[model samples]
Target chain A: MMRVAEGSYAIADAVRCCSPDVVSVYPITPQTHIVEHLSQFVANGELDCEYINVDSEFSSLSSLIGASAAGARTYTSTTSQGLALMFEVLYNASGMRLPIVMTTVNRALSAPLSIWNDQQDSFGVRDSGWIQLYAENVQEVMDLTPQLYRISEDPEILTPSMVCMDGYILTHVYEPVEFLDPELVKEILPPFSPVNVLDPEDPKTFGAFADPSWFTEFRYLQYKAQERALDLIGKVDKQFEETFGRGYGGLIDTYRTDDAEILLVSLGSIVGTIKDAVDELRKEGIKVGLVKIRSYRPFPVETLKEALKDASVVAVIEKDVSVGYQSALLTDIKGALYNTSIRVPISGFAAGLGGRDVAMKQIRKIVENASRVKDEGLELETEFEIFDVNPECL
Target chain B: MQESLFAPGHRACAGCGMPIVIKLVLDAAGPNTIVASSTGCLEVTSTPFPESSWKVPWIHSLFENPASVASGIEIAFKKFGRTDINLLVIAGDGSTFDIGIGSISGMFDRGHNITYICYDNEAYMNTGVQRSGSTPIYASTTTTPIGTQSPGNLVRKKDMPAIAVAHGASYVATASIAYPVDLRRKVKRSLEIKGPAYIQINAPCITGWSYADGDTIEQAKLVVETCICPLYEYVDGELVGVKKVRNKRPVEDYLKTQGRYKHLFRAEGGDVYIANIQAIADRNAEKFGLLD
Candidate 1:
């Protein structure tokens, strides 16, 4: 498990071994340890890169966007509010096809700040053009760091990839992680060679404005080109298997979905909890399973429908809410299956926002509630049903 | 890569002052440089692909990150075994002096061999002329509209050159399209330096300033000569050279040239505000060791 180590260093070490050339980051809570450790890496000459101590998180991504576009293997780690500040540059990073990798240690956005684990941080960034992958464990975080490069820099993909891990859960907690040798990383990722470079000798221009007349076409290229990258998500994941031995999914990862009547779906580190609960439910003769989606945008539609096609009840448990409408994943998942033949009823449940624990205890409760609703054959409340909503905590 | 780095047709407004400044900057930067563009009017107008006006390889990351992005480019080139290349970060005044100050400072502090150019159009011309850090006092931008009693802006122009110099920049200079040779010479000199350098050009946007398109080059010269924005350099934080106050013209001449500043003159004329502007220009001259 995470090399039998706990604390924030595993995330930092996983990143350090990747040998990022520049990390333009500003420290925000929970995320501070990751950058602080990386800063130490730069200070000790262990990581051969420039650690840009930016003034704000806004500047952090802005700086990373600069360095990454300049053809550097750039990395940044940020939590909730810091991420919001960098929001302005997030879309530009992906739109320009700079293969910048970011690790969003999930946390709740603040006013009355809670430096605890939550999914709101990463979930808020669902629309950013960067490819999004949720790590199920520290091991996945370690593997996914280098794997992101493969997915993002592929000639077909040439898009940004964000490897998201739960803040306190995976970012802080330790688990089994096989540190891939540096030589292996080199063999797999090599150095970043930007499809576009800012060279003075053979000068070029970038990031020029696109007004209304051509802005849609540019967006069309982004949306259409993004799908091509989704194809490379598979291509790169396959290549990742050849080099790293452990293979990650291009979109969705399933846990015993075949012949299962009740299927549980979760993202990030909570998947492990859901998996454990599924095992406990299986021992009791209940055919419960899991569908963990890694790549959220270019949301895993076809693969999801193909994987969870047979489940009688597909429980899409979400961490963050879309405020009023369907859970973000439910909307995307429904749309994914709208044109398809799969008629599995996706029971949407919202849980674990603002660091509220979606514990294995709660996961079992949600699954049971879904099963009971289906057995009754009535409309299970379509809007998100909180498993345990208490005003005392509020 | 070819001679026509700037294509003839662009979506720039008919009387846009940006193209002239860009042509001059690119000419100074020459064809071989790679550009790190901050999101701005220049980038938006010049690069509406499948038709790019760029002859050289240019990249637009975020609006306020060109300096940082240039740093990344410098690091990338050095790390990937590239040498003898120049990285130019071209951003608007709004991007440079305001939103991107921290990133620019970080780049300067890191001591990268990059040149950054802030095309000082005095305000945020891209997102519709809003007030910016570089917007002069008493100017009417969308954010800082002039009214009775109080003049538009109470604050003076931000001291960006002083800030860049404070950050251990090897070379810092002010240049305008009005002087191509000096701009080229400064670009060439700044090119030889092995650390971050700052060059802020006095580019006036006719669209925002309510001036004639053909007045673009002339107004730029006016900014330098009138001493409203004197062109000077500070090396190791010491005054090196001033862009010269050739027949130092009255601030009124420069002010009268643009509609944005027309309010500063008022219905019968705001003599008090005019005097205050004169004082700012005088302070600039003596502060930079310009005219005796």
Candidate 2:
């Protein structure tokens, strides 16, 4: 059915279709409406589950951990400080191998306390061992959420998953989205039966103390599970496409990058604007392209290499800076291209931080900057340039 | 087969009072129960690797979220369509009175039907007897040591049961391992309530209190008899069971048995600290009507 809906409501509807047995949440901006709609669904008898209005983000994640351990499908949502408060239990949920799914609405961290869109909050904890997937629009947010439960609950990869969408950019925007039939979702995602749970009839101890002799082995298993997710992601996406007839480009998507001299790389809603800029630049016969990455954690190294292998110069644009070094995604790209012989000058631009608008003009400025670096044989003055930085006296 | 959900042959200090409280709680909760514990002496001592002292399902994660964890299990079972499984959370006093207070208070306010038991040993016994919120005033601890110019701790014990009641818990009670029947009855009664229930047991630490191995129960009994730790239960914001003291003992009788309070008797101007301690006990007796 083609219907207009906000991205948060679309995710809420998708979550309802998955029949999560428990939904625990504490309201945070940009993520509030997702849980609010679910609460209404539970209240109006549209959904049959336990809806808990936990006191804080800490308790929300903690309660989900318990519920997930007791063999119930669980869901939650948060952004910025809410996600920061849940930082400790995020590792606990994954290390215990509970198949809990969460929606992380991307927002900037606080000191100045700006309730704005940025990728710093999620990127800061990229090493926390969650399968992180970024969504570009309302349709992608609706379509990609249901596949998370199936991917997370696979016995080979019993890890938690985070479906991150840009805060207000994606969550508050309305778009025409086609929701899959509830019956189809039921057929695709089977009932959740965990391999290990807290059952009194068959008692077992979870979160036991692992001493020096065995602690590393447990971490090794967690590492192995993440390693397995790379393949599992492809299989799940293929099965989803086969059943639903719509497939997101499995790991990374490309637009007109087959024979381009310059390429732009980014993720989330910013990719849409960058793609438009790429098209406008290409009309003038400039050999430029765009590669939008969807999955950042199980990073698609081979896919990135294949897409940008022929480009003369590559530019990475992101909303977060790593303070003393380049942006996180740019550092990751450098690492991925380390051993490969595809040596092209890759420059990074930091834009749209703290909810500042990343207009098409700024994106064009980024493209021109990359073009100047390529044409004049110039090295990047800094690791990455802060786009639209204010001058001293201006 | 003996019917104890918390099994035996685990590691704990000799005359440690926590296992007695655990056994009483499990006996009252029966076999159809799940236990969620926090990081503390009981957890570290009970479930160390390949051997477990738990015959029931047990989980121990971080130190400050057992109540939140139990809330998860309780709701999960509710969704699973099985309401017969009793969920119990057990944590030490440090977890209950200090680091975990926010999580536990949230659990109580949300009105989940779970029992949270805090074994109050008055200090962080597992971490070498450091001071905690539940540590009594002027008691010697590793963190609040006795010096020439300084007595032990400068604050009074945090009134956790009162805090629980303030959160509108369906049931709140203070029990001691000194009286098994009273403790068991409170646990059973608390499990009957339909919302969050809290039972704080004053389980004196043998090593931390610097008491003889055989005097755990005697010390616990003295605490109640002297009105230092009154035994009482509250049901739905009403006081129901306030144990009366037939012959009230002085605070010195309870204070002299432990080394934590030994500093008061040995140090100069220590009589002032003892008078303050006596006043606190008198206040407890008056507030709870223990003299009646």
Candidate 3:
């Protein structure tokens, strides 16, 4: 990331520095560059590891699961359809407590074949036993990614880790990133020593049937492991700051929200653009700020309630939907506000799908609508719904 | 030597063939082996609340990750930070030969130190006798019910042992509850092997197959004896061995033993049933040299 570093390239460098022993990847648009760069590194003997170019996303994850069980530090990357294909594997990796690090270039799932920046794809895997981290800029992509191995591989948090960045926005854009030295990275992350490994020297068995008798208890264990992961995110963040010089704001990053009456809440790279708009609004004496979400899984309910406690109005801008219900991330934020004395009205806005541009101008308009709603005591259910699809090409 | 890993006394029906297979398999695996089970009848009926049916240290994960769980358990032993446990996974047809296919294949392709055993009764008997991929051709289950024109399942049974071998598994074999001694012997061999080894057992079901409780063991033997299903093994991803199919009879004998294939021979076009069974046996023999 020393030169004209694209966001995806920075992520690729972080993955290589993390020194994942096995990388199982399947390519999909906008997200492919991160994997492609990593693959090239492996091919050029730049990364000393097993790089599996899988037949499909399913195989990609399957390969990682195998490698993880073999006690190899594994990595994988995907987006949208690719993520959907690895849906079952996500559960398998977490259930088995394999600390696999994956990069998800967030994109929309297809019905009519959309490939755009959205929270839906990453949000879809919210319940799986994995520590989820969202990166808002190329620097975060470079910085937070290697942190995944530290957090995920922690014995107390032996869970899969996902570093999600906006599909095309952060993945395609070039930004100056200060690449951490490999020696420093090695000192920071340390080697992965597995609790379990599949080896022939000592015979073992896996993937047996758990009849109705004892299935619940094991599921409870998976659930508990995820809970353990939430705490480790902060613990790892602290150690990261000590070595790397910058700390990730646990769960959510707050911007100028000290006396703000209106707050823009979102995740992924959109937060960068929204932060700019928040600055612009502040210049005009507007009491507006931005909250960039980091972790989505083990969604920071208590932490978020504390962060947004004083805000008068909160606007949720999402790229994914719950269909007849709320947008995916908005629902979690609302649940965090539940039973709290802070009665900040929240509005949900769905925008950007099918590779469509989520321009700063569009985000500025959404922020404006949100600021206008703050004037009244009302919260709109649907505002800034800008993802209306045009007719398909002939 | 495994001292019958499953403790005696669990309700697996009056003539539950699986527990017996489990007992023999565990005996073959010997005292050092560990078992991971899936969510199914064997796991549910044996290890009910507050108690377990196992004498050995056993665990039950979800239906899908038993192989993966076993993979973990296997690696744990390899790391043996201090344990000498041998990992063994016992699943029903629904879980092993089907739902757990990916993890199983992964373990095999990676050559993990684990053994996967599928106690196949040809259906998802635990879930009320539904059709699974391993359900034999012309088998009758809730999902593959007998109809006016069709007998039952039209698709051929999946050759899971062969699939395991093709994945470069160290060893793969088919076993039957009818032959406890041989089944135990195979288990012992699989346990001793260095990489992923798979064993498929034709454990009959009294309720699912609509057979008399007494006939469970009888049908399991008849299955292989009739050549409808032959016991065999694939070594090093190649068809290197076969079990004895002595005095092979018509597929009808195996079919008529259970109600699953009752519709096959009873239907008007049932005459075509022999050709299908013959085709299966023919392919099995040709594929691995099982019969003359």
Candidate 4:
């Protein structure tokens, strides 16, 4: 049934459908409403799970590590500084192969401190051996919830996943979300059957210290599992679509990319505005299209190459920057296209950072610049420009 | 001979008190137990990949997270209806008294049915004898070594047991490796009592304390006998048990045996520092009524 609900409630309701055995929670803004709703569910006896109210984000993820190792399906959610606090535990969770799922309500990192919609937090932890999935809207966030659990808990792909939704933009926004039936969710995500666990019947050592001789192999195994998840992510999304009748294009979803001369690549909710800009540009006889990246981590390199292969130029737009270098997505895309047959001039644009609005007009200017690069045959800018910067501030 | 849960093929220092504490704690917890260990000498020595000394299920997460991890395991077990299995956390002094204090406090305050045992080696022995919150006053550590202008560690040990009690732990105790019976009894008792329980065992580090490998037990006994490290128990916030120090020895006898305190006897005005340490013992004796 469809219900008009806040994004946080919808995400919480989606989690309720999965019926995790343990939910460790610590509150941070944008992520607070999700956990609060989960707590209320537990209090009302609607969700039959152990609700652990932990002291800090560090403990929240730490407890989930233990809970998952003990053969419990576990979850937690946080954003920005909270996610930064959980940096160590994130690597630990994936290294232990615990299959814990978390919702990273994406927000900007601190220093000037803004609790606004941005992907900087999750992007900071992109290499922590987790499968990262980005959602463009409230409905997509709700839909990706069960898929994350299914993909993370797969027998071959026992990796943790971060289902990232733009903080406040998706978490605080109200939308009509189609809640998945708990029965159907069970069909897609069966009961968690762990391969190894803390059990008296069968004793096993977990998180053992690795010596120099064997440390590389341990990391290699984690790498191999993550590589395997690239295929499993798409397979599971296909399964999710068969059950729920809604499937996000497994890794990279394309809109009017076929036979397009220019492609705008981006992730998260900003893809919504970029798509609108693509439509406006197309009406004026400019063949601009949007390539929405749903999964950033096992970074759909092959699929991305295919999507951008036909375009004359590609514009990589994102909400985060590497500060000294360019945007993370632009860097990754540049690396992905390099040495491959897909030779196209790629322009990197840093937009919507720290929750600065990335309106359609700004996206149009990005495309207009890319159009100029294509028309003039200029070299791709090595550094990304802040898309909507006010020159007066400088 | 009965088979021990904590096997003997690990790489602990010859005279280390940590393995003894681990063996005793696991032995008391028996076969039906799950252990969460923090990063410390005990964890590194016990489980070096492809070979583990543990016979029962064991997990070692990060340094400051065993209490929180054990809390998760305890609740997970509860959800599985396997409350019969004892959930235990074993960490070191550095992990307990300093970096891990917040996580431990959270575990106790939340009231999970888990027994947390800190094998107190007094310093961060795993990282080359650095000073920790549990390091004794005026005791020389790498970070607090004797210098022209310095006098070892300046501050006293943090009162972790009292802090545990303040967190509303159902059972809180202080034990020593010299008395295996007392240490094992506390572990078993903590497991027996429901809700959160904490026991800090004074496991003397032969290397960190700069004592002879053969004198690990002797050092353990002397610290308690001098009233410097008292053995006591609190049941539900009440002082129910105290190991009285009969024929109490002076602090100088204990301090003279370890190189960590040898500087106290050599430095100018060192007698004043020794007098101050003796005053700590006197306070502990008076507070816990340790005198026979």
Model 2 earns a TM-score of 0.97
Docking class of 1: medium
True-vs-predicted CA distance for residue A208, candidate 2, Å: 1.2
Instruction: Give the better candidate number (1 or 4) by lDDT.
Output: 4
What TM-score would candidate 3 get against the native? 0.82
**Candidate achieving the largest DockQ:** 4
lDDT of 3: 0.77
Off by over 4 Å in 1: A16-19, A39-47, A186-195, A211-213, A229-250, A378-383, A391-394, B1-20, B81-83, B149-151, B211-218, B243-247, B264-269
lDDT of 2 by residue, A68-104 (tens): 9899999998999999998988888888888899999
Off by over 4 Å in 4: A380-383
List, residue by residue over B131-217, the lDDT tens digit for candidate 4. Answer: 999999998999998999999999999999999999889999999889989988989899889989999998888888878869989
Model 3 clash tally, residue pairs: 31
The DockQ-derived docking category for candidate 3 is: incorrect
lDDT of 4 by residue, A344-384 (tens): 88888888989999998888888888888777654544236
C-alpha lDDT (0 to 100) for residue B73 of candidate 1: 69
Best candidate according to TM-score: 4
Chain A TM-score per candidate? 0.94, 0.97, 0.93, 0.98
DockQ (Cα-based) per candidate?
A: 0.53, 0.77, 0.15, 0.87
Clash-forming residue pairs, model 2: none
Listed in order, each prediction's TM-score against the native is 0.90, 0.97, 0.82, 0.99
lDDT of 3 at B169: 88
DockQ of 3: 0.15
Model 4 vs. true fold: TM: 0.99
